[model samples]
Target chain A: MIDNLLFLAAPITVSIILAGILSYLGNHILTRGIIFVDIAVAQIAALGTMIGLLLGFAEESANVKMISYIFTIAVISIFALTKFKKQVISQEAIIGIIYCLALGTAMLLAERIPGGSNFISKTITGNLLWVTWKSVLSCLIMFILIGIIHVIFRRHFIKISDSKNGLPYSLWKTRAYELLFYITFSMVIVKAVPIGGVFFVFTLLIAPAAAATLFTDSWKKRLIWSWIIGITGAIAGMYLSFTMNISNAPAIVTLLGLIVFLFAFIKLATKRIVSHNLSKEKGS
Target chain B: MTGLEFMFAPLVASLLLIFITVYFGIHVIEREIIFIDIALAQIAALGSAVSLVIKNISGEAAGHDHDSRTLLAYLFCVGAAFLFTILKNKKIRIPLEAVIGIAYAVATTSAVIILDKGAGSDVHIHDMLTGSILWVTWPQIIRLSVVVVLTGGFHYIFRERFRKVTLSYHGVDTGLKNPKLWDFIFYMTFGIVIVEAVNIGGILTIFAFLIIPSSISALFAKRWTTRILIGFLVGGISTLLGLYLSWNMDIPCSPAIILFLGAGLLVAVGLRAINKLFSHQRQSR
Candidate 1:
């Protein structure tokens, strides 16, 4: 039993590290008002995996990973260029539509190709328990590299995320900043998506950051709290799933969901209590 | 009656969806929740997947049909709408799209997990996404027709109220009495329509059906009546051509039909571009 429990250590830890990385991306996503880009990028990466399978590449091969990153970065570049523009159809609508298109096209290709169905399930609901140390080691290396790059050019990302849409295209600085942000973010997504899948990645990315916003006005403090929430939620979810025979992905997702709701409730209740006390004092 | 028996049922089913989706699509577009159909549809499908896992674990054979699944789906979809309506109370708390994206993430992940636990989950999910509308039964068709007609009647009667609620109160401080109730009604009717739709069609085809027709029409049509007419016209043309091509090429029905709609949209865009150039030339002359 102890060994069985200990075996879950690596996967859980990797998920925590993943949470730390993606929570920052989640912050940018929330700030940008484009929350669904992760899903779209995740789907496009899955499409890359499908394309790899079509080309006879091994399921977890370097070639497959390379193709996935290439596809994701290209898609992200397109988004960086044009998606922020004002359209008769809104930006969120376009993101949502692109999401469906990616999903449909991926499903069609998976059905038509052999050995593709396996990739489909892996893409949608990844096997978090089955992650090997070799894969985890590679993830650690990639995560460290991406983290260093992000820290080095963190200010550029800040400038890009803080910039409002509808800026003139002639300002190459703004355009370059936006492209830099997307490229780095895509790297983060391509690394995390294979193990955790879209939902796991997205929940880690958004929920902690969203919950943190209620507590802190400072981005620095929020970043710290986001990591704390994500790490705690992931470990607790793993424990509960192990004890209760629940699936891990859903377990983490549901717990994070509950965490967000709990934070919101607390925020609401505190405001009410304060207002109620103030009114009582005035009446007296 | 002829060798085209398989195509006939799917054709009838697609026609019914085209009728209602063209109407609902406008509201979805106006509300800027273009993926609401897919979101609600997935929520409904998630409900059924949960029940299936429950039954399988308990080793009991409960009846699996439209009624049980639709009930669970409405419970979920409406609950979701309630949460979303509150989250989107327009006080600048959290953006509506963020809330929606979060809900969508959690719902879909829970669904995938449940489906993974239950046997034949892949088949179940595939059926939900790319439904075998080509092989729909008579009883299913009759049931769907009844639901759609009843829904159409309700929509026709309270059309103005829906228009008022969606258009007037879009992200504004409405402060009405129980606007959640109004949002509940919208999601409920939409749930009823799309649950019936998921019964015959799947998420992929139904999503395409809702958006593509109305979107193409939105490009050109001005009045509501003209838009709906153009929607029907395009839907009919696409269905005919898609089915014909599917029959000839032996591809899957729904994806082929989706491709046809996409093709149709591109053609519409191409024609509009040509028209724009010609108009510019005429103005110059």
Candidate 2:
């Protein structure tokens, strides 16, 4: 029993730390109105990883990372177009189309490889439990680096999400800033997807930030609350999965979901009560 | 079966989708609900997952019982549609896209959990997402045709309302208020078509058919009929070309269709670019 605890301790810690970083990114995702970006980018990233493996790059090789990075850039460019930027198509819809395209391309590319399809599922669900200390360490370094970049240049990158409308040209100058953001964003997805999987990464990336946004508008407070929720969700999820003998990633996602809905409901209910009380006071 | 038969059947099904998807695409584009079909499809898949779980719990063999799954899927989709409409309520803090993303995550995770519990392979879910567009069965074609007729008739009758709601300048400026009745009608129609399309074409092919054709058509055409024609033309040619390439290259079929549509769009965009260039030159001259 103690051995199991020893084995899981590293993974659970990794998930919490990862969740914190993801929540920070998640706030940006919520602000940018590009919540599905992580999923779509992750899928494309996975496809790139698959093709890298197909081309005989060792999974951990720089070649695989390079290929995946290039694919992500191409995908970001495709999605950056004014046509896709139109208000006519919901941002999620464009993401969906891009998602389907990447999925199809991956499937077609992987059709002949042995266990290619399993690779696809693994990309989404990730083998969160199997994460090693080395990988966790690397993730830690990357996160700290990214966190520092974010802290130093908060004004530039955060605006991408808050701008709310406009094509890439209208949205930012030099296009360098937006490009940097997507590259940074895609870098996180590529790094995290192998350990956490697309769905888990996405849950970590969106849920805490989403739930926190419901409670307050202050960016700093929202960031703090978001990390708290994310850390809590991760620990709770890991515990649930461990006790229940279920998959860890799904457990984490399901828990995060419940917390999100709980927050939404609370917000909804409080507003209703306040409005009702206001009406009664006015009548009196 | 002959090559012709294989080609003909899928084309018929693709054609049936063209009829419904273009009209719905216009509304979806107008409403900025591009991911609605995916959400609805995922939700429908979740319902099917529930039914499949029930079937497993009852110790039934995993046979393809079409009706029960379809019915369950419909309920799940409409329920999702209702939720989506409600989520569009102004009070929510998240952007609508983020909400759609969350809905997608929850439904998908729920499906995964149910399937994992049932000890089912992921193949079923993967198939639900990618679909076998090439293996279009005859019965499926007939069902889709019926949908085409029903949606076509209803759309013709209520074209004005749909037009006013979907295309009016004011409605576009301020997001269309998805009143319960109109929203229900919208989701119901979208739900029915997606539930059926997923069965035949799979999610990827169905999505490609839904978004790409209409997007290309909208690029140039101003008139509604012209847009519909352009959509049909793009999809038809893409489908035909995809079938031919898939047959020849032995590539997985749906990707072929997607590739062709993608290529077709690029060509359309190129043509538009060239036209603009020529017009610019003429003006400068």
The candidate maximizing lDDT is 2
Candidate 1 lDDT for residue B111 = 75
RMSD, each candidate, Å? Answer: 3.8, 3.2
**lDDT for A34 (candidate 2):** 65
Could you report the DockQ of all the candidates, in the order they appear? 0.37, 0.49
How would you encode candidate 1's per-residue C-alpha lDDT over A253-283 as one tens digit per residue?
A: 8789767866776777777799899999999
Candidate 2 segments exceeding 4 Å error: A1-4, A54-62, A77-94, A167-174, A280-284, B56-66, B117-124, B163-178, B221-224, B278-285
Fnat for every candidate = 0.33, 0.47
Candidate 2: interface RMSD equals 3.0
Pairs that collide, model 2: A32-A161, B131-B202
Error of 2 at B264 (Å): 1.7
Compare the candidates by TM-score and give the number of the best one: 2
